[model samples]
Target: MKKFWLSLLSIIIPASAVTFEDNDTVVLLGNTVIERAQKYGYLETAINLSARKKKLKFRNLGWSGDTVFGHARSYFGPPKEGFDRLKSDLTELKPNVVIVCYGAVAAYDGQKGLPEFLAGYETLLSMIKSSASPREIVIVSPPPAESLGAPMPDMREHNKRLALYSKAVGKLAQKHKLQFADFFTTLGESKGLTDNGLHFTPEGYQTAAPKLVEALGLSLATGNQLQSEHARKLREATVAKNKLFFFRWRPANETYLRLFRKHEQGNNLKELPMFDPLIADAEKQIEALKKTTLSLK
Candidate 1:
């Protein structure tokens, strides 16, 4: 009995590798690479299915073409406003884990932008830390674009610069003692997975999901048909909840609701609070599913 107890203790608390705790709120932040994940639900599914001992909440805050400075998130305003919004979002979410994904698009600027890129990344980190102190921050390298046999018009050179950025991301992770995941090296040669050599096809996300979990030093449950079915259901609920949150946070018709041109359609603002209940209901369903055992068999 003593031996059994000791074994269980070691398994419960491993010395190395980052681990998520019960009820940890995880937020994924990045550009199109991360934004598109909402449609596929691959990564989110993997994380939820793998998290055996905990109930985790996830919020995806991905903006297509966004940079480290929150450029894409800024709607009819300066980058600083966008940055402020990012900070506000983080503050509101109060996530326990934040997965930072960037570098690929910024690499488009080439070697000349490396310094600025890193500086912006560092500033972003500062903002996250300030808002969500004592949180687990995982840095994920942008996956490399596929070449489809011959290098496609500067694609080779783009990948070369991307490698540099990936290296820098790894270094940053080490410096901060944060977790690091390299999609560039791991997701290499994504021939059919990508739609246009860059964005992932639905199948691509399915393939990359497990890799993301592994890169983070997490384990996946031995998924079975039953588990898979349940995962699908739970993921669908999660996606619904995320959508509600999105509307609440960044409404589509913000111009009239909260921005400069509000007088005309300001009454529509009443609809915003309606999402809260829907989001809450979806979350409840997710939590209920989490309580069930997700055994492979």
Candidate 2:
């Protein structure tokens, strides 16, 4: 059991920036947008598919309605406690690369909260740097909300504010010498992308994933060969691997598992560690499928 645990922990390792090394552990941190990404799997798929030469690991730590100040992650405690939890989580992951995405929700407050938002953002960046010391940090600006016509407020004005926030994020990235991806500017018109003004439709994430990959100086294997049945299998395998990883890293019902309420139902927490082996199996399957897919060409 000891040896097994050690091997499982060895899953995450350092990687290169221009392209991923075989053992890279990439962690995605942000808000609802990032959380929702687990369902679409476009971003993770793009990364895995684009990384033809190596296998990479990904862990998404997105919390719905989370802020730069760690609002959503705080549970019943203060935001500071949530911030500390974020730090601890990153430290545990020991990621080689971290993609930080935030700002859309903060932008809702408009200009009134921009300064505080930026400050908190910077602090969050610093904390991440201090905790994980990742090899590369890529900051992604939040996507603009669309005008959904009804209960949703006009997103034209919201988008203007979002631009400002995105610009601020870009400036911070430059100042900190980190890589930057501008989802805000790149997403362009909302159109049919979002169901409401704030969140994305599955199609929206799929459409945006490639742009993000491009922005990060990565390239996808897009050709007639990729349209084949084997290619579809590879895509499915990628999604399965990512889903297993998501559960391995970010399990649900933490309030009764890892938090204050654990005293009541913590015994069931044994199930959590079971995800590690499952994730490993999925990753190995992905590798096997990738080899078969590529060999066919």
lDDT string, candidate 1, 1-297, tens digits: 999987533322222445789889889999998988887677887877677758788889999999999988888888788889999989988999999899978988888999999899999999999987736898888888776555444368788988888878777777777778877776766567787778888888878887777666676766342237667776677677777788887898999998888999998999988988888788788777655536435
lDDT of 2 by residue, 1-297 (tens): 999866432221112234567789989899999988877776777767677868787888888999999968777777788888899999999999898899988998888998999899889989998999998888888888889787877878878998888878877887787777777766778477788778888888777777667656676776443455776676677677767766766667777887888999888889977988888888787778776766665
Worst 10 residues of 1 by lDDT: 8-17
Residue pair clashes in candidate 2: none
TM-score of every prediction relative to native:
0.88, 0.85
Model 1 scores what on Cα lDDT? 0.79
How does model 2 fare in lDDT? 0.78
Error of 1 at 22 (Å): 1.3
Q: What is the lDDT of residue 270 in candidate 2?
A: 94
